[model samples]
Target: MHGGEPSVHFINSVLVTVVVALFVLWRYRLAILGGMRRGDSAFLPLPAERAPGRAVLADGDIAAREQAMRQRVAAAWLLTTAICSLPMAVAYMVAGKMSASPTYALALTCSYMIAALPMIAVSLAWPPWRMVIAFVVMMLSFAALCLLAGIIERSLLGRPLSWKILGLVPLFFDIAWNQLWMAGLFWLLSWPTRLRGVVPITFAAVLVFAAAPFAGSRLTAVLAATEVGTPWVYTLGLNGVFMLIALPVGWLAWLRLGKLAADYEAKRFSDAQLLARTWWLMLVVTIGFDILAGRERPTFALLLVVGEIVLFPLVNHWVMRWLGVAKLAAAKPAPTLLLLRVFGYTARTERLFDRVASRWRLLGPVTTIAAPDVTARTIDPGDYLRWLTGRIDDLFVTSRASLDAKLARLDLAPDPDGRFRINEFCCRDSTWQATVIELMLRADVVIMDVRGISAARLGCEFELQQLAKRLPPQRLVLVVDETTEREHLKAVFGPTLEQVRVIEIHRRRDADRAFEALVDAAGGAGSPPDAWSAGKKDGANQAAP
Candidate 1:
């Protein structure tokens, strides 16, 4: 088609593959490495002993800091959402061929609002389904709003309302295709990690990337019937170009991810820093998309819009860090709240943790034993990646001395969003019992969710016994649901069951009440009840249900 310049279709096809590959590695990282077995590498020698620094704060100062941290995080979320919308606003102006006028300003403002709505809504939710529901509801609402706005504008201008408004329905599908392939690529990445499961699906995404140009040309041929389909040779050349570009790009990102993962394991980088670095890499790749946009590229507008959406979370993260929200929360230490739950309740337990941590700052840092099933939901991508690479043989502490050292090195620091970086005990089957006992002794307050507990889960039964034996009645909160085996609780806790705060969570409000009870139990840890209650009253009152 040209002497030197690549066709827009070829450029965009390559961009899509590269973006899909990067995102798979970024967001679905745990899924990719889910199949790898734990390594058996010997533990490295412990680092030289150093006293951990302690920060002292007055009760008033602690409350003030917690309040200030929440405010900063909220501000950062709003500001980042606005900032991410700018790329889309400018894209609309450029693509629509509009000048800088009141009309353009209105378009920009509307675009900003539309782009910001879903993310802001999702951030307020705890459960994964709630987040998805929030996003979908906002998108549908925005679509309706757009149609109404268009109709009103056309009527004011004495113009007819055209059928083009109906295109919005298909437009959603178009955007959804982007998310679909991102999901597909992620799923494919996971398949190859499993030795036996490796098959054509592992390479399907790569092949799709390579064939994107031919696919695009075929669609163009169908839509514009007069135009010729791309020649087979041209298609092969585009595929080669895709491989040439994607291989090195993916490899470089892979190596960077591996290094970051190792460094995170070694504690060379904090979770927030690892996230910041990863996002910066994503931004770099996205910049490459803009560079490919070049001059008069038709796909550039949609590319910009999609890129803004992709970068929204990253921008929010960086904004919060820049605003010192993480630092503020990390400044003062509180008693650790140890969490245990039934293995089946992975998603629900994660949501509960989110609720408890987000609602009250007085609960301090949350710690838990990391079951493999919960790794994807709980652990940082870097550590998960390291585990996948078989570089984490020392993941679980094998001895009491080693366990103590690990505990001492725990980073109780919260992330930029104010969720405490969970100090998870990555324990082996043999070591988990000891790990639980140690953690139980150290934990200021314990919340064990035995919702689905039964005779089948002997491990949970053991945990229940340890909690009852190690922790006092006020220091532990037992969460049970209807599915809980009444006999197990009666047999284990016996007389202690009456004194223990047992909260049954069958509904959302029950969970909220349970969360409050958990926080109150946590207040019993190392702080006078009145002082803790006074400090947390405002936060609890304002907390989202």
Candidate 2:
């Protein structure tokens, strides 16, 4: 008796909108989880590249350039990363059902919206449309690959078309789409061409697995999609199981980073190789185990920590080592007097070199031993190291008396010139820092007051690297406050501490042990710094004399 109108048909457009909204929400959660930071720009690029490493002219202060670069990164991150596509995705998904065919409706938004951020990601990170084209090629290639795999597996296994359609076919399609999802961020990352293939592939795998809800098969998927309780069952399918897998994966990755840090510290590898291995492993783990299964448990926090191990190093290159963010941090926000410099004759080329070497060497042998890298503008790793390792209590003493005792126990060699060449500097009259370094280098019986210095600060590492190059670890009495340890130092410095001689003085009894500790740490009766002692008596005594 009652018939539906033939001219008009209604679909659950509201429901479709709700689904799109959910998808957008999920993406926002992921983006926030992954990259929310103090200066995040969400979807925009930094205003400019970080400052130049060093000033090319008095006209160009590289630090200024670096500031601009950071701003650009922040802005771009905000403008493109998580914001733009999400709102649009929700809008289109919501509007699709009410407007027409649900499939077409979503395609209109999904195709265009999905392409939006990814296009930006590739362009910014790699430039020249190289990665963009690469992505397209890779996507097509992957689709072909899946088709080939399906043909092969189908033929060999002799599985029914039902199995092929429901299982393998969907799996391959999922993987292909997942890759596209991964390639969406080249602009955001500014990655090299060489590195794209693996990361996107891995990312694709993770996404497919994560999207298990939508990828099952004809009967299974339809039931799951519309059966209300099907989602609950499917979610239960592997999330719990994957949590167990994720825990160990995260742990292994964390250990790997530590080993890498050590290898670099000990000069056992090149920086490029060191960083590459770390990155490759992380990418694999991020996609293979971390992304899909990781999100389902507290393991994500652990994964975040592991991510920090990788992220810290990158941050170091972009914002610290090359960006010189540490220099900026040390910069007196108001310009009070962080850098003590002296100009003219005060500048000792050797001593200045020594200080620079000492302060930064802790970053690792990769930096210290790498081919000389000079730039007009660059970020240094100081900020990055500090952020990752925190402060390692490398130096300490049991007691002041013990420290004194240790110093007394040292085989105090007679200073023929009453001075020691602790380090060399190319100091100049105008550079007060050079003047100070020169004085320190020329002082005999130098007591390295490593009081507040943490391995995180490039300052201590720089000094230590130079010391290793110059007098050896023994001649330098590393006076720690007694609350430090070798492991703590090693953790902070990665493997750079292999050459160090540590002495902790928590009590006065340790004093007599001090001198012997240094020599022992240095590995023998090495020749001391090549400089005479400061033989003059106290200022008052000299005045009276």
Candidate 3:
């Protein structure tokens, strides 16, 4: 067999695929094992009742806390940029024999931080749509930043700077193939899918590597004829490709470091073990990127790169610790949030969940039923992929034993960011009713969004009856809208309906009101004896997650 070393694309693709696949499978295995290893009862014991601290935390109080977290997230995003970019700045400074001024280095770093601010805001504003936003907002913002950097650099070098530099923005992104890579890579980076499926991320990387160069060449050739300097085009293209590949690798490595740190926070390992694990993961990721980027030989530059990679994680860990994510979570009780909704309300249901989930750690974890259809509403890529691959049986619980096992292992803990997950009960037609009853008993507070509820939704009707029978009215929040059939709902609950807290939400403000009611029901710092039950019959508010 006449064979040469594998092409860069082939090697990179293989490495990405293997790394991603193994990580996904490993996480999946851990999930299954977690479920099996739980020897507790099918549901957690109910939390003991406590006296209400204050009459339901004020809306402003909750808002202020949420705002604080957003600040932390923004700060973390900027810090991440600084950690990765500063190392490169140092390398450039050294390579240029100190020709790179500290002012310029500071300016470059400041430019990156400025560019990232808008994206961070966009991400925080709409987490569910972050992937799409990254594609549009991130690329445009990054292009703008590059243009500004170009202007500054030209001015510093005593070279001509004009509107012509704008032409080179597209030329840089296109010729460097950054535009293509950003579209795919950013989507992967901002993936809303909690499963963290690598199929799309790696697949996109491979496609970009294989196709961007040819496409970029034709596009740039056209741009090169439009009064832009040929030298600038080549320079940007040459430098941009290295960063195109390296950025994603660095970000991916950060993701791994996060997982390890989370395990440490959760007491999965001691200090020494965490250090060892972090070092091993960082080494593997750094070396993998180096090899894929064609830096196979040992050199001083490579050594510097290694040091940068090593320092990056240390900074990451420090930032996380400083943010007090673990300490904050530890102080809060992660009560189970039981979310029940009318079937076929996927869009509204997800919007509801997104609203509450943003501050869920303040209350507790969430539990809900997996809708019959998988949509972007709930990013379950692993479940969606399995469905596509005809592994439908794996998506649903067919037996009581399986449902019990699922409930036993269900985690009600917050993630490293102090955000809790919506643990879904994927049940078959035969077991959903039973699932509903068990979840009702286990929930600290039940949020049932019966918007558009009608006589025909027998399953929702059944859930209503169980909620009325098992959960105290003080512990339940009923969400309704104009579409809901009130008479039918009243028929199911009888006199009990009078005591229940009801939120009629036709707008965003109503959702905020509803969130407060749920917090009161969950017995957080602000629950009054009748805080939620006041005016039970008047219009109120609702959500699904």
Question: Tens digit of lDDT per residue, candidate 1, span 1-545?
Answer: 22113334433444454455445444333432332223333433433323322223335244355457556755665577457655655655565566654333333443344333322322332444554675577557655655566567668878877798667555544543432333233223332211111111112233334444444444444544433434533554545544645666556556555665565555443443333332322332333334344434435634663575467657776787788766676666666777888775645775666565434433366678876444544455445455446655455666557678888877665545654556777764455677677677766677788777767766587788766766676777777765678777779766666666666665454566666566556544332343223323423444333
- For each candidate, the alpha-carbon lDDT, in order, equals 0.52, 0.31, 0.54
Clash-forming residue pairs, model 1: none
TM-scores for candidates 1 onward, in order = 0.60, 0.23, 0.57
Q: Which segments of candidate 3 are over 4 A away from where they belong?
A: 1-74, 92-99, 114-314, 361-363, 372-395, 456-458, 508-510, 524-545
lDDT of 2 by residue, 1-545 (tens): 01121001111221232343334334332332232222321222112222212111222232343344334433333233223323333443342324433333233223322333332332222233444685576445444445555555666777655544335434544643552333333223423332222232223223333333222322353545677848754765555435534555555544544554454344343232232332333333333232334233334434443554454334323432343333433332111001111112122211322232221211111011100111100111221122235421111112334233422432212111111111111111122222233223322223343433543433455444433434333334554442334444445434434434334443333333443433232233443232111111111132210
Off by over 4 Å in 2: 1-128, 158-173, 179-262, 265-545
Worst 10 residues of 3 by lDDT: 1-10
- Model 1 TM-score relative to the real fold: 0.60
Which candidate has the top score in TM-score?
Answer: 1
Q: Write the per-residue lDDT of candidate 3 for residues 251-296, one digit (tens) a residue.
A: 5544544454455446443222222222223223333343334444
By summed lDDT, which 10 consecutive residues of candidate 1 come out lowest? 193-202
Prediction 1 global C-alpha lDDT: 0.52
Which candidate has the top score in lDDT?
A: 3
